[model samples]
Target: MALTLTCERQGGNYGPACAFSEILALAERRWHEWFSQAPAMGGPYRDQYYYAWWVLANNLVAPFGQLRHEALVPSKKQYIGVWNW
Candidate 1:
């Protein structure tokens, strides 16, 4: 996933092989976790889509540009959801 994001930024060059870095591994873990917890909003993975955007915004886009995109605030749906929030 990390490799895909960077390669996309580079316009599909896919130059170097992605190293098995800890951060990349963590990102993958979080992605899976988000999918697992998606049932909180709806069973068809509706909530997961929001979190995927959150991951791109918070973890990838903002950090890459070194600018504040927005606060990493969880929406009310998260904490108040029926599933594990």
Candidate 2:
């Protein structure tokens, strides 16, 4: 039930090892909870779950964003690239 991720850079000194699979499972659970609790798009929940998904996708390269780091740029850019838009 604890939702947490270790800073990879911190290594073993931080705490127990967190597998990538665990992260994926927790992310899916959180997503499902949001989907179920959230109202349909353009409805009262418009500003809730839908916005949450958008933020998650854009920030973490979720499928909804349709943009990946590979297409963005090798180096950080001041603005989002065409692929991201």
RMSD of each: 11.1, 10.9
Q: List model 2 lDDT by residue over 18-40, tens digit each.
A: 78898789878877886677556
lDDT of 1 by residue, 1-85 (tens): 3534342335546566556585488678877785666444657776677767665445332334444453343444454322221
TM-score of 1: 0.28
User: Which residue pairs in candidate 1 have backbone atoms (N, alpha carbon, C) closer than 3 angstroms, thus clashing?
Assistant: none
For candidate 2, the per-residue lDDT at 9 reads: 38
- In the predicted model 2, the residue pairs found to clash are none
Best by TM-score: 2
Task: Give the clash count for each candidate.
Answer: 0, 0
